[model samples]
Target: MARLTILLVVLVAAMATAFAPVPLSRTVSTTALNGQTRVEVKIGEGEPIESALRRFKREVNKSGHLMDLRHKRYFENSQDRKKRKIVQARIRKRLERMNARRMRQRRS
Candidate 1:
């Protein structure tokens, strides 16, 4: 009878521990330099790592930057080289702004 009570207590404790979820960061980002893509993801704070990664992958895929790269190179010719530099500069500027915003939030 004592052994049965102990077993029941152990089972309940194990079950409680097993169902507990680890608290995780809600913000995740992935930057692909080759593709010139930076994705910012938010999953409402406390989502699992798996969910964050999945959402990151989905955002990257949906960004269309990969397909844009396939159809177009950042620089293909002399004329395009000039334009590519301009476009690249613009993209870099945008990413810098985003990074700054993230930093500001982190500080707070």
Candidate 2:
């Protein structure tokens, strides 16, 4: 009698699950970039809708799509770009030297 009851319960549970509708959201895709595998994820079932967009944005950032868009947003001559980069590099080096000096002083 206990066995029969357990079997009936399992059968009913299976039927309920089979008939229950499952909501699925699509936000998973695989892409190949320069022979490298890239997996992107988005929001899915039981996840907030806003999180899906955030995931997409993060994926774009990982793929450097956001950087590309920003670069293409303005028209700049190659020479100007090079000059800008040189100035930025100079500033970065100066900052690095200053940081190193500060660190050495602290250690001493």
Candidate 3:
């Protein structure tokens, strides 16, 4: 009788598990660079592969890993680095001024 009850319990548990809603599985992959940056994307069970690839590319671009890698590919001295930073700052300031002027003109 005990063996029969055990078998029944097992059978009920199996049925319950079989009927339970199964979650959609996702595939994830991560690429790490220098142990500092990682880009990851998950593809759902029904999601299109093209969409998943697009999402991965977007994530990579958004993370700036490619840019960082490019910048670090070559060695730059302190003076060169400082010059580059100054040029970037000047460009940023110019853009900000242009934007502010546009806003002021729009207000008029």
User: Which candidate wins on TM-score?
Assistant: 3
What Cα-based lDDT does every candidate model obtain?
Answer: 0.77, 0.77, 0.80
Candidate 2: where are CA atoms >4 Å away? 1-68
Global fold similarity of model 2 (TM-score): 0.40
> Which is better, 1 or 2, measured by TM-score?
2
Compute the lDDT for candidate 1.
Answer: 0.77
Clashing pairs in 1: none
Candidate 2 lDDT (Cα, 0 to 1) = 0.77
lDDT per residue, candidate 1, 19-93, as tens digits? 666434545556678746788886665567698788888877888777677747554777876886799899999
Q: What value of lDDT does candidate 3 attain over all alpha carbons?
A: 0.80
Of the two candidates 1 and 3, the one with more favorable TM-score, higher being better, is 3
lDDT of 2 by residue, 1-108 (tens): 999999999889888855666545654555878966566675566888788877776676778655656776899899988997899899999999999999999999
Best by lDDT: 3
TM-score of each: 0.31, 0.40, 0.54
**CA displacement after TM-score superposition, residue 16 of candidate 2 (Å):** 43
